[model samples]
Target: MSWHLFVVFFASTFFISATPGPNMLLAFQYGLNYGVKRTLWTLAGLSLGLFILLLSTLLGLDVISRQSPWLLTVIKTIGALYLIYLGISSWRDTNNSSLMSDASAMSAEVSAELTPNPDRSAKPLPRSLSSAAVKSVPNDWILFRTGMWVSLSNPKAILFFAAFFPKFINFSAPLWPQYIMLTVGLFLSETIWQLIYTIGGKKLAGWLDVGERLAWLNRGCGVIFILIAAALIVDVISTL
Candidate 1:
C-alpha cells in the first residue's frame, strides 16, 4: 500500500475503534473490575474474534448474500435479539446493589452472632458475587463466546466489512499483502485503543473504593451498556 493509503487506513481504523461501542464498554468494565491484565486478555480474545470474522469474509463466506436472503435475515434477527437481551439484562441488573447490601448486612449479623465478646469489631467478608467479577472476569466460555458472537453476528459489523474492507484493496495487486496490511492495521488499532480504555478504567476503579460505590458504578455502567444495546437494536431493525 502507498503511504497515503496507509495513512487513510490508519486514521479510519483509529477513529472507528476509539468510538464507544459494546467491545469498548466490555473492555472498560473488564478494566474497572479485574484491572488492566484481564482487560488485555479480553482485548486479545476480541482481536482473535475479529480476525476470524475478517478471514471468513475474505474467504467469501459472505457469498451467502447472493444465495439466500432468509438466512441472512435470520442472522440479523438473532443479532438484534441478542443486543436487546443484553440491554434489558443490563438494565435489570441495576438492582444488584440491593443484593450486595443484603449480603453485607447478613455478613455483619453473622459476625455479631458468632463473636462472644461484643467489644470486638466484626470484620466483613468479601462478597462472593461481586460486580467487579461479573463485569470483568465473565465465565470463561461466555467471554470467548461473547467475543465471537459480538464480532461476527452483529449486522453492523457485517455492513462495515462489506462497505469498508473492500475499498482498501487493489484487485490487481498481490492479495496476500493487502490482507496482511488490513489485518495489521485493524488489529493494531483495536489493541491500542482497548489498552487506552483499560488504563482509563483502572484509573476510574481507584475512585470506587467502597463496595457500595463500586456497586453503584457497576449499575451505572450497566445502564450505559443497555442504552448502547438499545441503539444497536434500533440500527439493526432499521437496516432490516
Candidate 2:
C-alpha cells in the first residue's frame, strides 16, 4: 500500500474505532471496576479477538458464511445470550454493598497509612480504591477471556472486516507486508481509543464515588449491554 492510501485507511479506521462498541464498553466497565493496569489484560484480549476476526475474514469467512449460513446464526444466538448474561451480572452487582464497603475501607486504610508522609499525594488513592472495592476481582486470565469472548461474540465483526478491508487492500501486489502494515495501523488506532475509554471510565468512577451514583452508573451500563443484545437478537430474527 502506498503512503497516501495507508494514510486514508488509517484515518477511516480511527474514526470507526472511535465509535462506542462492545469492546470499548468492556474496557470502560473494567476500568471502572479495576484500574487501568488490570484493564490492559482486557485490552490485549480485545486485540487478539479482533485480530482473529480480521484474519478469518481475510481467509475467506465470507465464503464460509455463504456455504454454511447456519453457523452464523448459531454464533449470533450464542453471542446474544452471552451478552444477556453479562448484562444480568452487571445488574446484580448494582446493589453489592460489600463491594462498596470494601472500597471505602480500603480508601480509609490508604489515607491512614499515608497520613504521616508529607510528600504522599491523594491522587493514587482513587485508583487503589476502585481496585480494592472488588475484593474478588477476577484473575488476569479471566479478564482476558471475558474480553476475548465479548469481542468474538459479535459474529457480524467478521462480515464487517470482510467488507471493510478489501476497500483498502491492493490484491495485485504482495499482500503479507500490506497486511502487517494495515494491522499495525488499525491496532494503533484501537489501542489509543481503548485507553481513552478506560481512563474516561476511571475518571467518572472517581467523580461518582458518592452514595448510589456509581451503582446507578453500573446499572446504566447494564442497560446498554442488554439493549445491544436485543438489537443483535432482532437482527438475527430479521436475517432468518
Candidate 3:
C-alpha cells in the first residue's frame, strides 16, 4: 500500500472506530468504572476480537456461515446469553464512593437525632472504608472477558468485517501483505480513537461524581447490550 492509500485506510478506520458502536459504548463505561489504565485490558481484548473477526472474514468465515444455518443460530444464542450475563452483572454493581456517601449521610442524620438520647447501649458499626474500596474494584480478567464477549458474541461483527475489508483489498497483488497493512493500520487507528473516547468518558465521569447514578448507568449499559443481542437475533431469524 502506498502512503496515500495508508492514510486513507487510517482515516477510514478512524471514522469507523470513532463511531459510537457497542464496543465504544462499553469502552466508555469501562472508562467510567475503571479509568483509562484498566480500560486498556478491555481494549486489548476487543482488539484481539477484531483481529479474529477480520482474519475470519478474509478466510471466508462468511461463506461457511452461509452454508450452515445452525451455526448461526448457535452463535446468536451464545452471544445473547453472554450479553444477558453482562447485563445482570452491570445491574448489580454499585459504586463504592456512592455507598460511602450514603453511609456518611446516614451517619450524620443518626448522630443528629441521637445526640440527646446518647445510645450507649447499642451502636451499629460504621462501614469500613477499606471494604468500600474492595467493593469498587474488579480484576483485569473480568474486564478482558467482558470486552471479548462483546466482540465475539456480535454475530454481525464478522459480517461487518467481511463487508468492510474487501473494498480496499487487491486480489491481483499478493494478499498477505495487504492484510498485514490493513491490520496494522486499523489497529493503530482503533487504539487512538478508543483511547480518545475513554479519556472523554473519564472526564465526564469526573463531572458526574457528585450526582452520578452508577446503578442506572450500569442498567442502561445492560439494557443496550440486551437490545443489541436482540437485534442480532432478529437478523439471524430474518436470514433463516
Give the runs in model 3 whose Cα sits over 4 Å from its true position: 61-135, 202-240
lDDT of each: 0.54, 0.66, 0.61
lDDT (0-100) at residue 105 of candidate 2? 52
Pairs with steric clashes in candidate 3: none
Q: Tell me the tens digit of each residue's lDDT in model 1 across 81-134.
A: 554454355445433333223323432343244332432232222364354242
Which pairs, if any, clash in model 1?
none
Ranking by lDDT: 2, 3, 1
All candidates: CA RMSD (Å): 12.3, 11.3, 13.6
Q: Over 4 Å off in model 2, which ranges? A: 61-135, 202-240
Q: Which lDDT tens digits does candidate 3 get at residues 72-170?
A: 456565666666665576667655454334424432343344233433442232253233222343466756766776677678776555544544555
Best by TM-score: 2
Alpha carbon deviation, residue 126, candidate 1 (Å): 8.3
TM-score for each predicted model, relative to the true structure: 0.52, 0.56, 0.54
